[model samples]
Target: MKKIFTLIATALMTVGANAQDAKFQIYTEVEPNTYAVTTNLDAVKAEFGEEKVTEAWGMGVWLPVDYVLIDNANLKATTAVDLTPIYFSGNKFTDMQKEFPAYTGYMNLGSSLGQNNWKGTEVIEDLTALKAAYHGAVSVFPKVDGTLSFGVYAGDNSRSIGIFNMATEDEMNEEIFMGAWANYYNFRHDGVEAAPDGTIPAKGSAAYVSAEVKAGRQYILVGGANKNLTMHQIKFVPAQGTGINNAGVSSEKTIEAVYTLGGIRTNGIGKGVNIVKYSDGTTVKIVK
Candidate 1:
């Protein structure tokens, strides 16, 4: 009786350990491009060396002229795999550059109208161009099954953005509803006016949100609208092992048998490290 009780307790503990999830945060690694925090051009030029600031900006902008390219050499979230850059027609080639750390919302650069002069009719500038500076997208491909959580810079007003898990790149052609910080209808910039939406975060804070993601699927964070939204600190937390094979093959193969790490046959997955045998004769270790 005593031995049986001890075994049951051990099994419970093992299951708890196996159920633990791990979170990995991805950051923009390129020099002078910290995502979560905002910085000025002077600081960027100082840190990124003396290679003419405008020239550097031109190179960075021109490289991703057709599609979004994010450097992921320091990625530790899951099995590191090359992610394809996603392109959007809204992204236009112009002198306007998408500065890192801060996105000052889409503005009417051509109109010379300032945010402070929104009410004053000083020739209301065209603050309505759907420029890619505020409409860029980031793509993430995870080898492990997990959910995604990310933070976007939020100001006194609500900014619009979207998160989508797509099976193919072609699906990106469709539209996605704003997933976080939907637009605030009121004119409230610089904390002069109260945020119309109660859910809007305090001034200069990050609004964090979560989304479900599957293994081997392409997930994109799209700048859905011209609301001055900025993305940062994209993270993926593994939930459970999906049936993806070690060779990067995603399969829904039926389970034929299960066993413990020590090769002890088990009726079903219990705890600790589980050796799962698939109907196709492939075996994989799943923790859970």
Candidate 2:
């Protein structure tokens, strides 16, 4: 019985070894630019029949393996190489100005696109060189009366870097002063008031119409005109239903409250009363 068991085990091991050494029959094509062989299973099936081809798998299409049946066979192989060169294209400021005339003046001045000056004068030969010469910078601006106000300047020449200031007087030297002023005016006018209870009341509430509140700070214009009024900050409370108590309580109880730092009396008024109050408790009213 021991002899019989030994014979059975030896037979199984021999079978496993034969299976491991079995070579898959495959048809190969030599690559034109490499010392590699590509197997075409479908072609092999058509030429040698499906039964003879058995199973087929691709080694690699570009650079396959070099098969050597004999140990003394001399076979050499090479890998794919990239020889492409990287090139850098500078900011096309001239093209931008010519193509978009309205924006051309600013683009040419180098105040609206990218950095004003590049460290290198030669065209960037690679990504590494371009990154070293040109990079972005981040700047922070404190809010005017707790309101964020920031500007960006981009240029290709030395004069491209425009002067920046926290105050309007400092911006006088800027060539685009008028444009900046207009932008600031638009931002100020678009502001909405906050409720006395420190919340943004409804659109028709006093808080919504009086002053614009953001974060924990409030803003109000002192003068009627943009140039006259310096932005001021104040604390605010949220005025909701029954939150505000003033004249005509029964008739205006539903309105919200928005208190300002200064009086509405000014040299030049724009449209409505600069000082706004919620006459109706549920609504906001602009009053001088």
Candidate 3:
């Protein structure tokens, strides 16, 4: 009996230890013009081979531009192989243009906007146009040596354009600053909250309320409507380390305000007040 009890306790302790050691992993898909680095130098060097790894700005990592080019080349080759069927089909230049916008756009430019016709007329024209556009828009910033480079280009008017360095795994784990950019949004650090459907609510409205987060949770201040059919200010002090408390005094205060202003109809002492119902199955309510 004593041995069995000891064995069970040991197994429980090991399970607890394993649970504590497990960390959350967040993965994001790589986007165009973006580069990522591993935190472990030895691991990175091993995967990339020592020759491909280099030191940039005192930090050792793989070459950013070269890495992007290599991946891009592989993608292009795969696409070309898959497109072999189109060559055999009775597809004309116009049909190809209709099928591939990017290819068509390039062809339009290569023909000098319909100026000169060349052999393999359509393909050459499209490629030439694409090359001109690529050269006009894309600029490469090479590091001191010829080993690494970063690409830059002008984005849409609403979006900001620039090169951004990424943080290595070690830097993220240690919270060390790795790189800087003019336009960066830290959604984790920012006080913005999303609705149940993951849509950001409008600012200054109950749908999208800003709150002070503490202990990995958010607290929002909900206000009640006033007598003049407008929303009145109500203090909502949320409980620490949890979301808004629907049954707290702060929620009651909002209910009272809304009832006084005729925004909500209530019955009985313990009944809740209905604020609004959304199509996404979320209900905003206040309770006593």
lDDT of each: 0.35, 0.20, 0.20
Worst 10 residues of 2 by lDDT: 4-13
Best by lDDT: 1
The residue-by-residue lDDT of candidate 1 on 1-288, one tens digit each, is 011000100001111233222111112212221222112244334433446445444222111211212222111221111121111112221211332312311211111122221221121111122233313444455555666655554455544343444334233223232112211112222445344563544455545556666665655443324344444445555555543323112355577777664556689867554555566554444443
For candidate 2, write residues 160-196 as lDDT tens digits: 1211211222233443331111111111221256345
Worst 10 residues of 1 by lDDT: 1-10
Instruction: Indicate which candidate wins on TM-score.
Output: 1
- For candidate 3, the C-alpha RMSD (Å) to the true structure equals 28.6
- Give TM per candidate: 0.38, 0.13, 0.16
User: What's the TM for model 2?
Assistant: 0.13
RMSD of 1: 18.8
Sort the predicted structures by TM-score, highest score first.
1, 3, 2
Candidate 3 segments whose C-alpha is farther than 4 A from its true place: 1-68, 71-158, 182-288
Q: Pairing residues by index, what is the TM-score of model 1?
A: 0.38
The CA lDDT at 29 in model 3 is: 10
